[model samples]
Target: MKTLLESMAHGCARCMYCDDSRGTDIDHFQPLKLAPLRAFTWDNHLLACSFCNSNLKRDQYPVDAAGDCLLVDPTVDDPADHLYLLLRCGEYDSYSKKGEHTIRVFGLNRPDLVRGRRDAFCLACSKPRDWHNLRQAGDAEAGRLAQALFDSPFVDVVHAMHRLDPRRAEFVVGTHTLPALEHWQSVYGG
Candidate 1:
């Protein structure tokens, strides 16, 4: 637990599956009962929320027709490749079979989670949207807002908004000239 916390700077690092809640438990990706040999292995462990660990996941690890895990490892895979964020509704539109399974199994689009994500995205975007009023502010102000977005709860939701076209991301920005908007573009526009 200490190792996991230290690695993520004690911020819960968000749930590995849902990318929302603070990870609250040490979950064995491969259940100990299913893979006893790896019980003490490092790679086999990941941080998860109690809800995911005990309720949503609960020792259920699905496998493909070839017996490969359907779950995507955050350390080994790019989640965005399988899932795309819906900016307006704050839901996910899956692009793969694994993505669908991951979303269903983890309740990734649960109403509460979607609402929370929407709220976070809106709050983070407000910083850039209000940049006109911040022209006289110190250079570090914009950086601080961006940092706050990264450190705040539901960061995955906040970061996901950056994947959209700037004009489509109404909360973020529609035009240039705002330092906050520029900072967002510089960091995530690529």
Candidate 2:
């Protein structure tokens, strides 16, 4: 079960919630105590880090006024629909109740995670230009660089950048890097 959950995780099997640490815990998205009937259910399992599963979320499950789960299930939902990353600060802003709840439960804005996102964003912004340079020079290493960029930690940052409007993306990554980013997005499908 743990193996299966890990296989479902994104970017080198990172934690589904934080997308930072390795997913070492087989977390029950719906805690066994709250949903005992789902104990053996595959869809109820998720890959999580120790910090997210044990320290933060634990067995708590918050629901909205409508009784719908407030947590964002990465496997079943598009997190971008609820949460948006602020490129300047590496913090996430919530546009939905579920996003807000999930941020609180997962500590998405924790200092370490914020720093990681910021660092990853900077690196992501730079890598496209590097790839472009390598490709322009006809270097064989371009593919490897592209793969590493895609597999980097905090990959959600890159995805968010891709989802940005052209003007905003150009502003965030700068005009020089924007074209390279767009080229990579076109080739990689973001």
Best by TM-score: 2
**Steric clashes per prediction:** 0, 0
What does candidate 2 score in Cα RMSD to the true structure?
1.3
Misplaced by over 4 Å in model 2 are none
Tell me the TM-score of each prediction against the true structure.
0.83, 0.95
lDDT of 2 by residue, 52-124 (tens): 9999999989987887899998778999989999986999989999899999999999999999999998898
Best candidate according to lDDT: 2
Q: How close to the true structure is residue 146 of candidate 1, measured as C-alpha lDDT?
A: 57
In model 2, which range of ten residues has the least summed lDDT?
Answer: 2-11
Residue 2, candidate 2: alpha-carbon lDDT: 81
Alpha-carbon deviation at 1 in model 2, angstroms: 1.4
What is the C-alpha local distance difference test score of each model?
A: 0.70, 0.88
